[model samples]
Target chain A: MDELTRARQKACAGSRLSFDEALLLYRKASLLELGQWARAAKERHSGKNVYYNINRHINLSNTCTALCPLCAFSAKQGDTRGYILSPEKVAEMISRAMQETPGLTEIHIVSSLCPDTNFSYYTDILHTVRKLLPHVHIQAFTPAEIIYFTKISGLSIKEVLQHLKDAGLSSLPGGGAEILDDSVRQIICPDKASSAEWIETMKTAHSMGIPTNSSILYGHIETTEQRLAHLFKLRAIQDETGGFGAFVSFPFYPQNTKLAELYTIKPLTAWENLKFIALSRLVLDNIDHIKAFWIMLSEEIAQLSLAFGADDLDGTVGEEKIIHAAGAKSGSIMTRKKLNDMIVQAGYIPAERDSLYNIIKQAVPS
Target chain B: MDITLDTIEDKIHSGQRLSKEDGLALYSSNDLARIGQLADSVRKKISGDYVYYNVNLHVNLTNICIGQCKFCAFGCKSSSDKAYELTKQSVLSRIAKAAEDPDMKNLHIVSGLHPDWPYEYYLDIIKTIKANFPLLHLKGFTGVEIMHFVKISGKSIETVLRELIAAGLEAMPGGGAEILDDSIRQILCPNKATSTEWLEVARTAHRLGITTNASMLYGHIETKEQRINHLLTLRALQDETGGLQTFICFPFQPKNTALEDSITRTSVWDDLKTMAISRLMLDNIHNIKAYWVMLTLPVAMLALGFGANDIDGTVGGEKIMHAAGVSSQKALSKNILIDAIREAGRIPAECDCNSKIIRTF
Candidate 1:
């Protein structure tokens, strides 16, 4: 039989498809067959469910010490547009959310690796959120932030996580895991956490039972193998701790980033985006979910991903700065009804879920 | 726009708790990616990168049922073509074969309400397995089956559960909770246990210290509000008892069953959304499962990202979902499961009946 047929047979037989076999499938398999296998595999677990959540995102500050070339979101401390939301300001934002959207389940807090912010400032934000909205889940900070916290606090990673957890920090987001390989990290985010540090922080978090999400930033300054290696590294860590909740892939948006000057970067094609999502499904078998971030992929492609092994459309983000800073024009905010409509239009069910993939509400297609 | 998107974003950033109305507004909003992002954020907070599974074998003791629920394709009349009950020897043999695999840590046994079999027969099945395989965790019986046993044996729900526990029943499978609304249950499964009875059984199981899983079968005649109510009810019970280990959802599959013509199968989107919403709503429940058999493996894997942290594992000889025209593999090899979990970028760990990790792959 041909390689595709052989792979299909192996998949059908419930056998583990080898890496080479997966590579072959990626290179040679028909999109239709791949989608069928992916959809079948997805349905075996999620069935008709497509999960989304409602929450606000807080990019604590744009000021940073490690201004990675791939980032357009960060600004130097004294830069004209640089500003940090103080703990009180953060509290005001969260209180307003509670007053407006009483069902708000989470507050996603992430930021650049700002050198000016001390560890206490970070913990203070957590404390403020907790004191104001004790019931809301606080999903804050990234590995990069943790590493930064360690530098400022002079504490171990474990200590930082403990303090954050004590301050009512719920969990970690999977940002700054742009690429797990050192080579890619150096090229993309050199001043940030080394791949080793990122993995170490995540490992430490998992060991502490602090669940975190995983992500890969691709489509810039990386080879196919580097991307594969990034996934493999994440898979390896997941195998070790079983702590990661979801794996999200962000295609590089070169619109106005510093890296755009050094190298010409074109956006990933729809085919490339879908293939990455599908391959992620096929390769990251140990991980339960893959997301097509609609902010990066656009609504059309994100909807198509339901068939391509992505069961999540990210969420009804009110404001997202990172990708938009990089010149993403797909608009930062989406309404819940619009998200549901997209999923329904894509012939899948639209579900409103929490930060942790819990179902908040399920929308039936009309 | 009375409530601009910015207002919601401001509220969320301020770390405010969302009310039911706010939740409805967010659920009905036009931003799909933002909702997904929020769910992803919640998923990261609760489950982390570890996607849990177990190496277990499903052994259905019998398919014969007295109640002909409209959505059930596995149940049959005693005289039906698929009606067959396993003898004690046969059941023991199946367990023996399954136990031969050293990794087989759990034996999940759910059966139809056999009219002829006495309570002793059911007890014997568990006793036989436990007697032969002491190390194996035996997770058996749904709320419906427990109710059936209670009726047949004239025993209280607690008494039946206690007896089953004594006979090696480690946990209760959260089945037959199709929808906790009596109106829908009357239409879908009138002859089965009422919503109260199912909740009572679950509460009894929890009270006896035998943790149970909970499930919802949606996409039939139930409205979205009813679905939300069902989740809220589950959350309230979980708050009271903390007896639920996981909350799983089944999309209504109408094929080769009495409801086939009346209701079509739920779309995969609906299934995914339900799982996500369940994760968001059922905050007290830690684990949410995506049953690959009913959902298909791809959707289940995608569910890992949506909100579900557990995929009910390596089901050897699964029958109920298959009876409803499920086309996925009946059983998955441990390696295949590990690979699937790894492929999804999650940690794959073998869990016992209680969702305790046995080994990480």
Candidate 2:
């Protein structure tokens, strides 16, 4: 059999596909065939259950020292649009969120690397939220924040993560791992976090028993081979430690970002988005979940992604900021009812999850 | 019972008709490129590397319609400010301008159900347009319009269609088929032809030697099941009559319509997947048209690989979809459509009204 046919057979048969086999299937096999196999593979992990979470994001600040041209949310230190939220304000917001959403299960917090703020500000936000909403899962501080904390406090990556974990950091939200290649990172986010730094921080978090998700920001200047290579790299790490909880694939939105006008990059099509979802599902078999983040993809394609091997639809984020800054019109504040309806409409059970993959509730379809 | 793409491929390869379950499985599959490949394979079996376009003129005769479908933006009530009917002189003059192009092979006409016009009004318009441009093939009116003529003129559908053929109406345009299910029709379009009536008109037209094209207006409120049922209905009719010359799909333009607030435009994913599924389902139908007027230029070009073989026409000026907030050109200039077809990596075959190729680029 040809390489593509063999890839197709292995993928559809629920067998592990090598990186070369995945690339061949991804490029040469029919898109529907890949999705068919991807869906089966997703069922193997997720069954008929599609996951969502009731979460609220507490953005610490948009004032950043590393103003990555790829980010539309980041602003320079004295910019008119920049503001840093104090720990008191974060505590107030968390209380308001609990009162507003009594069922809020996760507190998803990721923010910019503020210029002059000491590493204490990062641990303080986690401490305040953890103190108030003691049981709510705290998925805070991506590797970018960890690496930044290391730079500011002169602490090791492991030491920084241990401090944050002691202050009640539950897990890490997977962000700031844009393309996971230094070549692409050099141009897109040269100052924020290097690829190696992000992975080292993640490995450190895993060693300390703090689980995290893996991700790649795709569809920018990255080639197809680069995208596949990034997935393989994640797979290799997952095989080593099995620390990654989920793999989230984000399509680069090039609306308000400088990377858009600099190269005139258009937002990737839904076809490409679905292909990436299916490809990741097939290649990253070690990772247990593939999140179809509705903020990045609209609700329509996000729901449609369930059939394309996406088993998780991220969360019903009370409001989102990062991608919306790049002109995402997917709106803020998705109700749990809306998430359940979308999941049910896609012919799956609605699984409400916490920061970890523990199911809080599974809605039985009427 | 676990039907897969492999099983469906087996059916298609051996020339066996896909069952309804098979069609549903294909629609539900997320592997679009694979489904598109199957559709393109079917398309290549019929016409290899030859994508067809026509130098035809679209003249929507009137906007005053009684079938005020919730999904439609063009059909205005008779008392509405936007309601307007065209006189014979106005329509003929419109055609006269486009008739100057020696390659203009078809004068396509479809309009809303004007309340006051007699059946002879339509007959008289067709006869006059045919007489003025003897070489232009008159492919006008839809199955809905034909049924409307029957209602107003108090004649049988056969008589109405026969009189139309006599008046130089050589073929019919496929519109007014929202979804071939009455449950949807009752909620969206209550007054138009029901599921069976649309098929009956096509059946009668095919029996009388009139060329017809089948179509569906999707992306509003129809489910995949309804979409497949609609296609299978057309496939069954085409199987019986072998009359439909082209199968067209108009992704519903919900802008400026009643469903605008509730409905959003379907993604390119659904559009191309449906196009490919239609090509795979309707095996008997020889042509599948990606009407650029509804699906803009880039999507139509992409549809060429997804089992669509015809771009409908140059569309000298179409007001129905344009009124419904379509942004495609009213009329493409000379060789623009040709260049577009060439850019899609297919030979542009200039076709006549029934999609008969006259010349190829």
Candidate 3:
């Protein structure tokens, strides 16, 4: 059989696609035809349910040492706009969130690499969150942050992860895996974590019995082949570790970033976004779910993505700053009601999930 | 009969007419990119590589009106502070300043029905614009406004159109047919002309050799059958008269209007799908317009992939949709339009008010 036909048959039979086969299907298959296959793949994994969660995002700081060209949220140490939230401030925010949200499931915390803060600062924030909301899941800190923690404390990756896990780090948020290739990262996110360092960090965490999520930040400088290669890399890791709870795809938003100013860039079109979602679904056969991050892709595209093989809408992110800094407008005010209504309109059942892909609530069809 | 995208694609390939059932099927299809590709194929069949835009200005002479359209946030009571009635000189100055750019070609004037202004005042304004910029094409008014003139002056529709033509009015726009069905119009816009009267004015204007365009205001209180029938109705009229020049679809902006509390604006899916279906259904109409004022420039750029050939003008200044709380820019420059068209991988063609290609960029 030809590459595309072989790829199509493999996908229909719920088998894995190789890098070259996935790239061929991406280029040759009609958008609708591939969408049909991805839909079936998603159904075999998660059925007709589109999962969402209710979580609160607290950005601890924007002050950073390595302000990548692709990031707008990072502020230099000397910049007057730079800030590092104190433990008191973090405590107050969590207390406010606890009182405000009756059924909040997760405390989603992601921050910049502050030069002024040590390992204690990271662990203190986790301890403060665990102290306030004892039972809620704490999905904080990326592999990049974990690697940074080891550097700041002179600890190994295992020691840093163990300290944070004891203090309250439930799982990794799975960012910092931007394209998973050092050559691409050299342009968009230089001076951060290298591809080997990021995978090493995730694997170390998983070996220590910690579950983590995985992601790819596509649409910047990465090529189509690179995106496919990234997927194969993640699938191989999943096959071995089986520690990834979910996989999210974020299309690069280039509004206030230096990359945007350097080259005239338009964000991914709806066709590209849905196609990326479908491609991820077909290739990452071992991964349980493919997420359409509604924060980066707007709620409208997120709704339409349900048909294009996205089984998860991420969450009702109480507030988000990273994407908002890079020119996404869907920060704050995404209540559970709106997410439910949106999923229902897109012809899927709304499923309220925890951070680990466990359904806490399922919205019955009315 | 089973109507699927396959049948629709086959028909589009053969250049056969798409039935109402085919239009419905295309709308209900979940794969938006396929729909867009098929529409672009149909578009390339007729419009070729060139995409058309015009350098024009919109002039609203007054907001004092008798008809109380619930979907209208532009018109106002004569005594309200927001009321405006431009004198003849102001109108002339507006046109003269806009005509400063040599690229300016058409003067677009769709306004409120001033309850007090005589029919002569309307004729005089057109004559004044024509006298000043003798080369500028005067594309003004709609079918509903023509019938309003018929009511106020007690003249036939043909007489009103002929007089406007004599006074330098070159063509009419296709507004006021918010859905060519009175069952919904009676509740949505009871004070305006009925659908029958609007179609009559369109037919009469075409017979008088006045080029006109057509539009349908959708996304509020209209069924799929109604939208399809609106396209079919426009198709039949174009087949008979062959006078209609283009077609545009306005997604109803449901903010700051009576329907704001009850309905929300349609989405990009609906907008692109509707534009494609309009192209598929209205084969007799040569061009489909993606009005940047109503559909934002981004969506309009994508509409090029869905069979939209004309991106309707710079619209140097417009206020009607803004009053209804549309967030699009009040004015777009000609360079921006050219760049957008070129960025969409299509050749940009500068055109006059009526969409005749002048030069390709």
Best by TM-score: 3
Give stretches of model 3 more than 4 Å off.
A1-47, A218-229, A258-275, A278-288, A306-308, B2-38
Query: What is residue A320's positional error in candidate 3, in angstroms?
Result: 1.4
Q: Least lDDT summed over 10 consecutive residues: which range in candidate 1 chain B?
A: B29-38
lDDT of each: 0.81, 0.86, 0.86
Tens digits of per-residue lDDT for model 3, A1-366: 777788889876878787888888888775555666788888899987989888999888898887888899999988998988999999999898888887899999999998999999888888898998899999999988888888889999999999999998899988999999889988888878899999998898889889999999888888889989999999989888998888899888898898888866667765677778888899888888999988887776787677678999888776688889888866565888888877776667899988888889998776
Q: What is the lDDT of residue A70 in candidate 3?
A: 89
In candidate 2, what are the lDDT values of residues B1-361, reduced to their tens digit?
Answer: 6899999999899999988899999978756667887998899897678888888888888898889899888889888898888889999898888888888888889999988899999999988988888889989888899889999999999999999999898889888877999999999989989888988998999999988988999998888899999998888788788999999998998899999999977766688789999999989898999988887775677678689999878888778889889867787764877876775567999888887779988
Where does model 1 sit among the CAPRI classes?
Answer: incorrect
Candidate 1 residue-wise lDDT, A9-78, digit = tens: 7654435567667777766764435665666666666778888777888888999999899998999879
Q: Is the docking of candidate 2 incorrect, acceptable, medium or high quality?
A: acceptable
Ordered list by TM-score, greatest first: 3, 2, 1
DockQ of each: 0.01, 0.23, 0.23
lDDT of 1 at A31: 48
Better of 2 and 3 by DockQ: 2
Taking the tens digit of each residue's C-alpha lDDT, what string does model 3 give over B1-361?
6999998888889878998889888877755656777877788887787889988899998988888788888888899899999999999899889989999998899989889888888999999989988999989988888988998999999899999999998888888889999998999888889988998988988888888999999999999889999999999998999988889999999888888899888766688779988988888888899998998776687678678999998897788999988777998998888887876667999877667788889
For candidate 3, give the docking quality class from DockQ: incorrect
Clashing pairs in 2: A31-B31, A31-B34, A32-B31, A32-B32, A32-B34
lDDT of 1 by residue, B25-80 (tens): 55455343344445545666777877788888899988999878988899998888
**Number of backbone-clashing residue pairs for each candidate, in the order shown:** 112, 5, 0
